[model samples]
Target: EYWWWSLFIVLAGIVLAVVDTLTGTMGMFGDSGLLGGLFELGVIVPSLALGVRRLHDINRTGWWLLLVFGFFPIAAIGGGILLVSFFLLDNFLILTVLGFAMVIGGGILGLIGIIVLIVWAIKQGDTGPNKYGPDPRMATSQ
Candidate 1:
């Protein structure tokens, strides 16, 4: 159930990203234009739910996922600093090209890291509960 929900969220995010590109390029947002909002909503709500389920699978409260997502800006800031450093320190065009490459490559690496985290979270948890709460996959023997 959770896996399917996560898959749905990922697919919806892709669709929304495509729609957002079209809307932005066409200047389609207005009172009548809902594609933009729909795109955002398509990504956010399911993402939140998936994040919650992911934490639950790990026997952790869903709030931790919120914290992790919220910290993304910190990583972005670090990446931006590295980019600026490359620009300021590099004298050769080749080095500048490398700098751009690092930025894009780093972004991809970061995204992969996020995917890995989510995947790890969604996988099977301990046989019983650890610390967070009940084993969501099982019911108490009673």
Candidate 2:
């Protein structure tokens, strides 16, 4: 598929992220913070769409994109929350075990999700037509 476009989109996201960071550091973007949010949204939307489309090219559903990026953050956050709960609660063994379990489970899922995305990102597109549709590479060449 359009690997180049995917690469470009990733780079654009990074560049935009850096710009947003700089803007936040300098406090120059705006007062409402809408611009900064827009900058963030700019990256999120394109990255998700690109990932999903690329997955489609490889005969995978767009949901895989959500699975990859979405699961990690959710897991990490859940882990963090559990970790915080461990500290706040008066109980020791029970809370600690539960908290650590959530944290570890979330971490593992996060890692797996990352690995899946990486595999998807680097792996070549389908050789010919796939469940998603006709091969973009083939169509373009023809």
TM-score of each: 0.49, 0.67
lDDT of 2 by residue, 78-102 (tens): 6666666666765466656665676
**True-structure lDDT of candidate 1:** 0.63
RMSD of 1: 6.3
Candidate 2: list runs displaced more than 4 Å: 1-37, 140-142
lDDT score at residue 41, model 2, on the 0-100 scale: 59
**Can you give the lDDT of residue 129 in candidate 1?**
71
Ten-residue region with minimum lDDT total, candidate 2: 25-34
Question: Model 1 Cα displacement at 95 (Å)?
Answer: 18
- Error (Å) of candidate 1 at residue 5 is 1.1
User: Which TM-score value belongs to model 1?
Assistant: 0.49
lDDT for each candidate structure: 0.63, 0.68
lDDT of 1 by residue, 63-137 (tens): 766554544554566556566666676555565555556556656665765686767675788667767666767
Candidate 2 residue pairs that clash = none
